[model samples]
Structures are given as C-alpha cells and as structure tokens.
Target: MSFAPFSDAPGTLDAAATAARLPWSALAEEIAALLWDSTVSVPARSVLPLAQGGSLFVMPATDRSVAMTKLITFTPGNAGTGRPSIQGDVVVFDIATGERRLVLDGPTVTARRTAAVSLLAARHLAPVPQGPLLIVGAGVQGRAHAEAFVVGLGVQEVWIASRSAASAEALAAHVHALGAQARVVADADAALPHCPLVATCTPAQAVVLSATPRSDAFIAAVGAFTPTMVELAPALCQHVALHGTIVVDTGDAGHEAGDLLQAGLDVATMPMLRNVVCGPWTHGTRAGKGPVLFKSCGWAGWDLAAARLAMRRAAAEPPMPAAAVRVPA
Candidate 1:
C-alpha cells in the first residue's frame, strides 16, 4: 500500500527540519509543563528483541489534544556499518479527529528531547547553569548535549572525552562550530573538577566516570537505560545518594537506571523530575550538597513533548513553495 502526501496532510519532517521546529528553550519548557500535566498519559514502552541482535521499542503517549507513538530500533552492531543504530519515526495524531498530523525523525527526537530533559534538570538543579561543560562520550548524544547546553544554558566552553580520540576531536570541532570553545580532554575524570556541568553519554557497558566532582557539580547520566548497562561507578552513585540529590527523569528509572540500581540505591524513594519541577523544592535547599545527579531513562512522554512543540512551530509558519520544500525521507 502506498500513502502519498496530500495537500492538507501533515508534513513529514526530516532530522534537520524537525530539529529546527523543536528549539531547545521551547522544547524544554513544553516538557516541564507536561511533566506536571495530569491530562497527559504515557504507557510504559514495550521492547522486543529482534532475531538479528537488535531491539524494537514501541512507546506511546497522549494528551487531551494530541497523541504520539515512537517506533524505533537500536542495533549496537550497526556501529561502523554506515547506518545509525537508532532509526525510526515519531508519528503524531490529532486526538479529536484521529487523523495523522505529523511524522518526525525518531532518532532526532530522542537526542533532542533527551538533551532537553537534561537541560530542564540543569535549569532547576544545576549549581551553575552557565559553564565550562564536560561531556563523557563523543557520540550523537554527546554532540546533542553540547549544543543544548550552549544554546539553552549559554555555556561558553565544552570539554569532550571519548574512548576514540578521532571521535572526541570530531565532537570538539562540532562544538567549536557552535561558537563555543571546545577542548578535547584525554581524561574525563581530570576535567570533572573544572566543569560544574557534566553529562555522561556513553554506551554504558562499563563505568567510564568515577571521579569525585565538585560540591556544586550537576551531573546528568544518560548512557544506561537497562539494569545491566552502567556508566558511573557504584561508589560514585552511593556518594551522591548519600550527600546530594539524585533526581530521576521518570519512575521507570527505578529498574532501568543501572548506575543507581547497581549501587544499591533505591530509585523508588528518590525524587523524580516531576517532584522537583512541580513541587516546592528550591536549589537553595541543596546548599553544601556533594552534587546533583539527574539519571535519565528513555520515556515516550518526552517524545510527545517534542511533537507538541514541533507541531506548534510548524503551524505558525506560512506554507513554503512546492519547489522550495524538501520532501521528507
């Protein structure tokens, strides 16, 4: 069956166009609003293992006016195969009419929304919002975080570290292109004390960051999404849990957050992003704390937030000439 794009049909945005629609500032705000919105409902995602050693994720979410589902695949073996390991689409629909409204690049949505979530966490939890940033792991997520922090937090400098020197340098160049001073660091641990804002975006097969950060550091760990995948040392997790605040993006992190789970941290007792954003807690309450750790596991609600922002931005613009428009992939 072939489905052609009708004149009134919602536009299918590619990665770049989708990114353009969901600006960091607006997207972060939308997510923050949605976090406390009772009208929005997000069911737990279903993960199915493919025969070829990959996983398919089916995540669905809905609000009073719109609904969305993110269908994506993650194939770790796809690395170096010239194809992205995570590729798919986020399909949005009008709740009243039940008509499809937009199709967004899923990987792009994941990267941006995840980074936006981190930005939102930083906005409320970071001891120092503007800063020299240290990102561990120079992959898509690392690059996305660098851009988000620079634009959203007005970060002026970024330090990148990866297992691959070439990858680290490439990310450094990307940061420099964003008009931020980029430094490639040989050791992420060595840079931790200097950077108040830190993001770990690694594969999560093992611990890559175990350093003791400054008392005011805000660390966002986005690498591990499973109980077995780990990026931070168990000791580090314990330290933060003991001294500082460890806020999770969602309650699902209870089982999916490897860094906390492995460290024997009871995620169920921790304050969620919703609590911090919607509750009465203030940054001043964290004075003299060791560090604030924001542990993020993937959630469909984040994708829905991105879709809402993208749809609003798309609606405000005048139609482009047919010839000037780039067809969606």
Candidate 2:
C-alpha cells in the first residue's frame, strides 16, 4: 500500500479512476472527517483577474499529511474556441518528503468534487436520496452530478437539460450507459418542479430556474462563481424564508456567488456546509418556507481531499499494462 508521490500531466489520470478512488460514500465521509480535524488548515483561495475578462485561481490546502494546490483558469470567451471556459491542473505533494505527488485534471477533479460536495450538503437538507434528480446544463458538471446524485446517492432517476439539445442528448446517452434511467428535457423549467433534488451547473448571466420552486426542493448550484454570473433567480433568493435557509460550501460564498450577491442576501448569516456537517443541524421544514439553496463558489478544501485520495488510489493500483502509459500511478 504505497500511496506515495508521483509526477504526471494535467489529464494523465483518468476520470473513472479518480471517481473510483474517491467513491461517493467514502469521499463524503472523508470530507466530513477533514472538517472535523482541527489540525487541518484551508485559507481563502487566491484569485487574480486575467486581462481577457477571465480569472486565475490558486487554491491550496493541507491536512498536515498531504498538501495540494490547484491552478484553475476560467475564460468565459473560450466557449466558441473549441476549448472549455473552465480548465486547470491540480498538483498534490507529500508533506513529509516535500515530493510532488500527482497532477489531476482540474475540471475532472472539480466536477467530481463539486458534485460530491453537493451530495454532502444534500445529505443534511434533502429528503431521502431516492427521488428524481433534475440536472441543468448537460456539460461536465451536469454529467458528473448525474453520477453523484443517481449512481452515487441512489436517486431514482435523472433528468438532464441544457442550452444545447445535442449536448443534452449526449449526456442522456452517457447516463443511460451508466445503467441509470435518464432523459433529455426541453428546458429546466419543465423538469424542475417534478424533481425534489436539483443540481444547476451552468455559467449563465440570467437565472436558469425560475417560477416558484417546491418548498422542500434542495438545489445545488455549482456554477456562476463570479459576481457577474447568476444562476438562481433573485426572486427565489429573496423568498427563501429563514426556516429553509440558503446553504453554502464555504463561509464566504455570499461574497462570490453572484446569485446570492445580486439577490442582496446577507450571506454572512447563511449556514455554512462545514457547520452542518460538523454539528447537529436539524433540517426539518416549515409549511410555507421557500426552497432550500446550496451554492458553492469552489473551495480548496474539496480539492485537497480529492487529490489525496487520487494519489493513494494510484499507488495502490496493479502495475500498468503494456498498452498503458505511466500515469500518476
């Protein structure tokens, strides 16, 4: 069981391998344990604005055992250039030896971590994980959420929709291949009401989900990280009564998530996921309270947990095959 350090390119590590390494249940539990550990430290991530309306993010964290840093770049304009708007690399290193561990794909790690964190938060707020799940945006995060919520959490089924129908169909096919029941919807509105659990994964300036949501609905919005981007409508944000409070992955998300910021929300008062995971936060509901919201602005804590697991899983694998190149393993 040599879960040690190695050097690899950004995408040398496969997504399935990463997902397998960080199983949904174990990953969520480890994240909870990481939150429980008082010795671990994670500061606010570093952000630098790029000249082209994009931004660069430097996220670092450590459990005093494994240290990791993720260099992420978000360029909104890259949508038309055949390149994704979100791209980066996660670099993990050994704390004892100061040796570099492995480099996992940023988007791959981000997609899995974001969805898993959503699952973590959902465990506290949402009803039993056996209901329909509505996933907006048929991109990486959308597909990943289908895996997390349906395959990971045992959701009964998944409904996928996107701005592009072709993309939606593509994701639907992928989900079906996973042996999960899924279909492409015309838009999010049609599917939003039926599903009690929803994961919004998009970078839209306008709100994607509108109209009154179910009072008990649990939404996890992973996109719209910038102050200029908004996912949930301000109307929805304003109506969320105290009983069904908006949840966040980090303490400072209200400052970063455009949805909450635009809604004029006092995000400081919003419940943080760490508190919910650490302490006893009863999520029982009231009759008329608005829908529950869980918004994430990306966090270094999640990256560190995912990276450490990936490194250890890599080292534990059997010797690489002749047809396979040496990855982080």
Best of the candidates, TM-score: 1
**lDDT of the candidates, in the order given:** 0.89, 0.78
TM-score of every candidate relative to the true structure:
0.94, 0.89
| CA lDDT, candidate 2, residue 178 | 77
Tens digits of per-residue lDDT for model 2, 1-329: 56434353333544554556677776776777778777777888889999978889999999878998999998878764668777888888889987775667787888888888898888877754566888888877888888887766778678887888888888888878877888778878877778888889986657898756677788888888878888888887777644467888887686788888888888888778887887655465323355778888888988888876777777887743433333445
Segments in model 1 whose C-alpha atoms lie over 4 Å from true places = 1-8, 320-329
Clashing pairs in model 2? 6-101
Please tell me which predicted candidate would have the highest lDDT against the true structure: 1
